[model samples]
Target: MKMSREQKYRLIEEAGEEELALLKQQVKQSPWRQKYHIQPSTGLLNDPNGFAYYQGEYHLFYQWFPLGTDHGMKYWYHLKSADLSDWQDCGIGIAPGDPQDSHGAYSGSGLEHEGQLYLMYTGNTRDNNWIRHPYQCMAVMNADGQITKWDQPVIREVPSGYTDHFRDPKVWRAGEQFYCVIGAQRENGTGSIVVYRSPDLAQWEWAGELSTSLTAFGYMWECPDYFEIDGQGVLLFCPQGLQPESDKYRNIYQSGYVIGDRMNMNTLELQHGEFHELDYGFDFYAPQTTEGADGQRIIIGWMGLPDIEYPTDQQGWAHCLTLPRELHLRNGKLLQKPVPALADRRGSKASFSGRFTGRQQVPDFAGEAYELICTYTAEDEQDHVPNEQSAVTAGQASVFGVELRTGENEKTVIGYDAQTQKLTLDRSAAGKPFAESYGTTRSCVLDQPLRQLHIFVDVSSVEIFVNEGEAVFTSRIFPSRGSQGIVFFAENGAVHLQAEKWDYL
Candidate 1:
């Protein structure tokens, strides 16, 4: 058995004055700041934790290493929002509050038991001999969302074959019973998920290991999340150290899901079919899932990759959550669509409804870094105007510009690509629009079924949710200060665009 969290609490210590000073300095100098979305404060942030809803407000907790972004003493950073666009930081919610967690308060989940909020987390510690210790624990929050220290760990360590690399507790309700899933590293260095059952929020009994993987899954599982959606179960996880099998696993790490049958607590076995990544992008990991008021299962992931250089470090801050996505299991695969609640940010009233046509951009509404969705005909290949090798042949993208403003003359651009059936991201278009791959294109499979792009941009990032969110392309773009024009262009053909704009103020 692992040391109880009560026993682990004796090792707590405030990070040294020098250590804390360094953290403050780094917070003031995060490389990703000024150009992208990040938690308002500093420190190292990883994994979206304790995402839950209570009393009508939405809460999002994250694994925060406040001593800069280098994974110092871990804490839980709290945020609350009524709408997804505007978020408020609630400060450190949980920390190395107990001796056993002197090392870190690892990732976990938040649950609503009765009227109170319950937090289940991993109490990570290091012994005098420097061996890693992880104790499974739970904490309760009063009506105010404040934690009353959970003195003891409910499950101390993994069974014999599992190592101390166990954490990331995801809890949910099954009928009248409370169940939890945790990522684990086996003694043999394999990744798997363990299960537990609890009648109330406090007491837990090990149900068994719910799922396991072979060598390809890497040595340890990071964030493990499971939920039922559209009559099917989806298990999401991030497996570390997985070598590329082929063209996949090409990123530094991968966050994906497996569509499976329900977890039979009695058998502790997962009846799974296929596995697919949640997003096909360079930065996405440690995803967390929570249920919405609409009875929808929505997921949010850390959009910053580990070991990757984030240019914003000079400004301070590292990563951010990708836009919230509503998860659905379509044909044995997990499909993520941006939540419908986001479109509510569509300000200035919707225009050009019922479909129309034109060779020009919409009138009266002109702004860069805005959202546009419209369906119209491309005047055909012969209708396009010639410009360099990129001639806009009728019916295709000849000119399109969505910009974001920082200074009087600064913005980012995400344009359309008709020849390649892709969308090009123009991070350099504001000034040096001709930089190498100045306009980066990505496959977006737009046709009759998906003729429009629901675009969202925040100065330095663009998330194009196409076909009502069926397919999504999220990337980071940094435009120069020389251009702030929200311009659009078309060739001889026409396109009817229904545009919406919002200030995330």
Candidate 2:
């Protein structure tokens, strides 16, 4: 059911206690809820915002619409963790009812200064004519975890030459001054990023649009994040209106990054390389990153997209944040690996090692919520002669991989085609289907020989890290409750396989 403007903007306080309780009950009854991922208790969640390590814990917030499973009346829902693995809900960090954020509390970043955490985010307001006016607002959290908003927005007006589509401020300290890069659209409607400099976090000066090679890439860019990794600058953003090209930009909106020499703060110039996607799967967007206390760059993304309806919406809930991933710059490309803290959630373990010629299911290797690490080494053709007992003639496997969440009539295949050297994820029959027009499969060509696959499977989602995060695919699946089987297979030839699985605690 489409929500009217009144319903969409209705505050949670306006709802009766019975109504709120019923909504929570409906969400609790949903079968697709994730086992370990951070999700909203009820309503919609998107855009991981205000993620930072503060005091003695990691504090993360997301854009939340508490009343329903639609993009409406957003609040900054909060969660904190000493270790990224176990999160404690803090509830409603920033409610949107003030004049600055009358419509919603949008996305932003977190910075720790002088004993407190400063939360800077976009304050979304709609005028009487339904025109959007975004404000860069700030809120402070003390050691006691009390959050207080500023009486006025730090940035009240959209700088000239950009439209109201401007939002998502990513702030960082560079030397002695703080810098911020915000996603914006030019007056002519093309996506761009503008810079700002703040000396004390109270007064900010417009630093001008960031200079880059991408002059006309997309219509609008959202959630721009800039950071330096290993002396190289990487800018990550979600650009809307990107047309599909070959196997890239297949999603309705695209999130990716460009890596190059560190930006020249004096000139605000970013001489970066071509943009490369951060995740090549069905559900990933608005990813935000923060440097951990150990100096590791870690990221978490909304495991869902905007304007897309999911099977869980009928249950009065939607979406979750992906498991935290540690980012690294290897050979000019970003490599993402699930953080080591996630291992804290590992329960019972299973192991398998052998030459698998065809589809085989090992005992204790099947589950809906677990982590699997498998390596397939194509056997040398000269070593294995053709035999009637073998599945195919003597040669390396032409195609190989695993099937997840398999049932009698459904399975999600993550396979690698040796002939084309392409890694593909096919969820055409994984389960309940939506967005079929965008296609049900996604693939990325591998530059090196296929080696290992590290997979994290939750009740309703899967995060695949290939070859130690040289490539990654994050997607959500809606398989039936009974589809908990997993199978490994090789086609046309046999391959040496070593596998291990750990059920999530």
Best by TM-score: 2
lDDT of 1 by residue, 309-379 (tens): 55554334556677788877655766677677676656564355322223333454444344555443333
* lDDT tens readout by residue for model 2, 1-505: 7678899998899988998999999998999989999998899999999999999899999999988988999999999999899999898999999999999999999999999999999999999999999999999999999999998999999999999998999999998999999999999989999999999999999989999999999999999999989999999999999999999999889999999999999999999999999999999999999999899999999999999889988898999999999999988999999999899999999999888778999999889999999976644466643232322222677888999999989999999887777899999999999988898999999767678899999999999999899999999999999999999998887777789999998
**TM-score of each candidate?**
0.78, 0.97
CA lDDT scores, all candidates in order: 0.65, 0.92
Stretches of candidate 2 off by over 4 Å are: 380-394
Per lDDT, the best of the predicted structures is 2
Identify the runs in model 1 with alpha carbons over 4 angstroms from their true place.
Answer: 1-38, 212-215, 244-247, 343-369, 374-450, 481-503
Q: Distance (Å) between predicted and true CA of 59, model 1?
A: 1.6
